[model samples]
Target: MPPAHPFDDDKLREECGVFGVVGVADAASFVALGLHALQHRGQEAGGIVTHDAETGFNQARRIGLVRDNFTSPEMMARLPGPIGIGHVRYSTTGSKGQTAIRDVQPFFGEFAMGGAAIAHNGNITNALQLRRELIERGSIFQSSSDSECIIHLMARSMGRNIPDRMEEALRKVEGAFSIVAMTRTKLLGCRDPLGVRPLVLGKIGDGWALASETCALDIIGAEFVREVKPGEMVVITAEKGVESHFPFRPNRSRFCIFEHVYFSRPDSILGGRSVYETRENIGRELAKEAPVEADLVCPVPDSGTPAAIGYALESGIPYAMGIIRNQYMGRTFIEPTEQIRNMGVRLKLNVNRALIKGKRVILVDDSVVRGTTSRKIKEMILDAGAAEVHFRIASPPTAWPCFYGVDTPQREKLLAATMSEEEMREHLEVDSLKFISLDGLYRAVGEAQGRDDNAPAYCDACFSGEYPVAPSDMMEQGFQAKTAAE
Candidate 1:
């Protein structure tokens, strides 16, 4: 792959997506479907591990989209099992551009009990510390991924069984994690104590499923059972269904709020609320907080569509598809020659010149990350003869990097970290720019009275700069957390 178009590269990337299904016929086939639904969460690579009595444990890991690698009959034939788990990766804690096959997951390991495979989402904050300690104690590591720490930890554990060993391993680990694993006869799922990332349970026919989001389950025709509660571990077998336990200390949940803003597909449900409705509510909140008079409201295409519709309905401005995305634009390029590189977002999105020629357009977008996409889009809208361009972002300013799982730029590389709203507006050269307030974001996500400062319901660390789990690795490298007074 030459490179992902910069048009899609500037946003905060979800680290990975995980899906596991047990008790289904040809479970790896269903796992592939679920991973395809979650391709947005991770497009870099994918893997599936399946277990059967005859084959024991089998896996096929590949680079690129799930549809490209996992869908073929020949590929699916290599994996055979009743119980299976799959992972699609975006590489938050590993090499970025040159990810190796060794780093692709649904990582497999053999133990005294049996062979087990695990797929993980979210970053391990203490992975560096654990890796050093494990290496000192003579534990060899295969890959450069932080998630591999879990396998090593399990290998060193003295617990009686696989589940007990897993508990022992996770207890020594810190930071956000939602994991799906499989043994020859069982499927396993769990979330960190604080539940900083999402993991949901589902039922399909006589079988059960576990996925990072409900959308993945939907693809395999699974019924949404409920979320795997914070700190809860579920071990599912065809005979016993699901057995739940808590292996970590009790703590209040702090789910990632950005999932509602951008990470999840709009059709999915989160916290018992429709993600589409929540995004529209975000638009309504943004309208109330920063009302802008404009001739039309336009979305920056798919991600921004729902919010734009809400803004248009609330502000009584006509909604238009002022910008149309090139639906078939391939994510990877063969090579980025100077001519193609300069095309910028035009390669992916284009202005509806006919409709936008004389309008004062308000563009509703999900977030402003590096600000490269926004600036280029603004230039495109202007070149299309739009009278004025105004920007309304759905989420609050992303001022800090997410240490949990989201692939965020270093704090200083983020536009919000170094510039004020007015400065950003000037930089983008838009008539005006605004982002939804944190309190407004809370209200939109179903908190009627807005955020509770003492203990927020969701992790807004990227916006608020307060991490629920201290990023120990970053601290070791001399990165300091922003204090309340900062």
Candidate 2:
């Protein structure tokens, strides 16, 4: 048949990134800059919606990079307003190609309270069930995106104001959501009760901003205010400053642990911990747990570099660039077909034969989903005359697929789901392969006492397989439900 898709082989993809601003001149410009900083989170399509007194609502949506679409004067000129929201999307709930643009978000709805636009960053696990209920009740969906359910829910709410209506609508929804929304006069941000996604608040000159990460705020020269607390909604207006409301019953926070391992920008801060530092700590922990005698420690490049540095420092091994990545190469996982992905890995990475020849090499990477990429890289390393190849992973084996915004392969497809460490090492044709322990990962992220079995401090569903929120839609669709211990 066909070669497996690269994303299925190794990479886990996040769904989208959102940014919004209020009380700024040409607000869409700031929104564009913010989205540009977040382009790493999602690269397929981007859209910006702005609200102006004279222009009403202005929208620009396109299927490409932010720099390709939003940087042009003509495009910026089309979106003029003092309040705006933008979204960069990588489809998880919708189809791909031309038709997918219909799902490009900052989805707008004309509610009884006027118009409201929302940009969402996480997946709603119960969207399919909610959509069926809404459709039966006469709500017409404009797009196939799960995010559309929020707008329709708001449209049907009888709450007195937009905020109350939004709270009412969200209460009926389930799963991870970090939402940045805009109305005629307000900018809003809120996180799911479990805090499975991230949303931060920032301040610009006299205005306020909301973004999926703090790096988005840094791009626009905004001061970091704080995170939008879990289960809490923050509403900002020029006259009223900022208002906070608890829309869901308080629960233990369960921020996605993968944010520190992957997903987030190195410069961004999540849960008050620096992403870079956390990565380095993961490396240190990996060194302690699985030490290898090697000629050199080399990273897979970019994502694996920080961890490799920590590994080298902890083990007193020399760190070298044994594999160099093509800086200009597009993300190989985003290639549409399996054939392109089959050839894409070579286009993105090259072995430094000069450095790797005759060396006992240790390769560091964030995580391995499918064993394909690892196996390929091992062949490349062996061809370059490496005496031995050892693989050091920063995170634990990805045993479960993430249903909350992160795109993962089915459980049966995950290498870790079926293979033991020894079996994986042999399968990848490496001398040794070691992944960080679940407890080690927690320590790396600053949870010193390790993961709380009673109530996990972070959402590690991919590793632990214990979903904090019930994946109602998946269960209804016949996927087996699992508990943390299972």
Candidate 3:
């Protein structure tokens, strides 16, 4: 039976994350290490493709985490090459129910022009429209992901250079994306015009690496290089590394601010800001905005733990692990069929009755999506004898589905998306609930609005609907009604 939470809603859905390395003896091994670092961005499927003079493109993929997928020693030994690209995927727009090996990536195709394999992050808002158009033009699609559309488009573009062809293909598509492409002799990286997803370049010992986060570089002992500029494409080959300008001037980089707020690991660096510092800053700002009296400040677990530390330090509240997380549960845990999805939260976390007995507690969390998990956790705490549970969200309420890659429920499903703080408090049965203001969040990211000379940055569309790319469908749906909707 499918797990109770068949949707995998407990963890944020990562569209995908990519890694590429060249001129390394242990190219496949290093690529595996990089993918392991990026495993947090995606967990559903993993793959790697290598390039060598003997074999143009050798590949392997499986339906699980990097460690699970690349478990066979034979699989690693077979992938002998000095250059390669790896990927981890969690589908956003495609068939979430699919378990087919063909659907896993580093998708490769052999064309009259030559052969190329690709890995990508982000979702195309106009994918439906573009897919229909491509189909009409006789471009057959193998996978449901909007990502496949780019490859077909690249094949069709009649540009002079590979980079120009890539540019032409990107010009035809709209939405958030950060792509990495590999051929027999080249590795290429591109960011969406708005820079909604992140891509970073790194350098080491006459070789280069590209990945979704700086954390990956740190894992492989590569020196950090600059971020791939918004709307820019860079192609690396034995000959030279090529960078081209954005086709048109973008107003500013609309990077997914959530990368700092929740999606990225606290140890990574993004958009010139330390992800950990940004999260802590949010906690400090949240504490300043809404001071609560409590015996201890406790985090939801994992993602919420760093913010809780900040909140504890700023509010002068002692911090404690009021809830303990079960370390054994993973993507394949057997629970959905026998257990309820709402009850799934307890499989991973249980309230420590000893820690919260008769004490007022402040709960710090990154954000509340469907509210099922939060509600369940809150109930567990109260049942454990807490005098009161006050909830503080590190970021503003998320009211919109993220087309960029985040897997949020429909509008009406989000608790805060539909209701006010008061309404959420009543609904979740918490003593109080408060969220950080959008302004406070921006301030915490450590950048002034107008400071950066290249790329003015601000893309909080999930909170403020000022999208760099418009939704193909007219009306927005699926967010929850505000707590106090009248």
Candidate 4:
């Protein structure tokens, strides 16, 4: 396995991205285009499955960027069909060190009626228990992925049709999920009861599309349709359009709040709100809640730019790109040994000595995970002669690990898990460190009265340490949840 990119080590990673289309010519081509737009969600590997009447089910899976793997004529030509689904992934299940071809999805399975391919976003908390029970009952497991359990469960189901089997399989499963699946002629989309992950419907000329985010729809010039409601399943075909059903009991939406902070593309919209606009609002809220008398407001590069712009506008401070990022750097540039690992941040970002020198700069970033990158970046600014460095985080401190689809570090490794705000400020050695309050973050995301303790609008488990869904697997492994006494 190749070494990971240096800068990406401390970041939270979404497990996967899903895109599917029905009723289109060379549907794999459209799927490829959509995956390219969603590369940010997952970058370790990608796969696409397509179905043609004459040729039957076809697929292509590769480990690398979408453009690097899926754009070639031979790869596209291999997948000749009118309906298809594609997945881009960063492995949260299966082998942790490196992703093998077997673990790559959209996972294909042969059922009694026909073959279907499924791509899943979000984690299944009860997968370990399910796998053990299935194996005991003579189910042959192939990949080490939690998602494959869905296929096995579907195979064992006594339902009349493929969708019915899927419904039965998912009914027994727990945790967050947004799934895109396809049979020979039909495309399908479904979200879990909590709507923990995102899946949207889109309309093309005579076709339909489903993607993890709206940005993928825009890449194909598809009209944005309504989102797939929580616990809802939609079966789409060229002739019949979209057929909606409720698989699980209705529940209030608990969308991942980090989608606005750092995950989804800035150009995308979530729950009728623009993600870019929300980040800017977070900046405004941060400026209002935690103001600093700094001469300039600077972002930590690409992810923090929007919020920094908002902060600058609200605070009447000049906004500047104090750090420049290398746009062409893909996931892995060089193999990281102990010493080479230290050079990672410098290879990706460089301090703008001219703009930063003699300026009291306030750094706006989405979140601080391990405090490794934040410390290194602070050192770079001081070396460049910045008078003072202040950190204004767009979201509250991330103290808990996410058990949903997101790949978060263990609680012990998270800086916020062990340290208070002042302790963290002293550890990072910044002039001051302030994170947006939980209520402020809620307000920024359009929750008018802020987060309701009675019924929160979004999944803020990372901030509040109060999980909406039980992490059954972790609990079995003896991981403790926050008690009332704490």
Local distance difference test, each candidate: 0.91, 0.88, 0.80, 0.93
Task: List the candidates ranked by lDDT, beginning with the highest.
Answer: 4, 1, 2, 3
Model 1: worst 10 consecutive residues (lDDT sum)? 1-10
RMSD of 2: 2.5
Once fitted onto the true fold, the runs of candidate 1 whose alpha carbons sit more than 4 angstroms away are 332-334
Candidate 1 lDDT by residue in tens digits, 1-486:
533444456788877999999998999999999999998898889999998778778889998888788888998888887889999988898888777999999898999988889989999999999999999999898899999999999998998989998999999989999999988888999999999889999999999999999999898889999999999999999999999999998999999999999999998999999999999999999899989889999999889999999888889999999999888887664356778778888988989999999899999999999999999999999999999999999999999999998888888999999999999999999999999999999999999989999999999999999889999999999988988897
lDDT score, candidate 3, position 373: 77
Q: Whole-model lDDT for model 2 versus the true structure?
A: 0.88
Single out the weakest 10-residue window by summed lDDT for candidate 2. 1-10
Q: What TM-score, over all chains together, does every model reach?
A: 0.99, 0.96, 0.92, 0.99
Worst 10 residues of 3 by lDDT: 477-486
Worst 10 residues of 4 by lDDT: 1-10
Q: By TM-score, how accurate is candidate 3?
A: 0.92
> How badly does each model clash, as a count of residue pairs?
0, 1, 17, 0
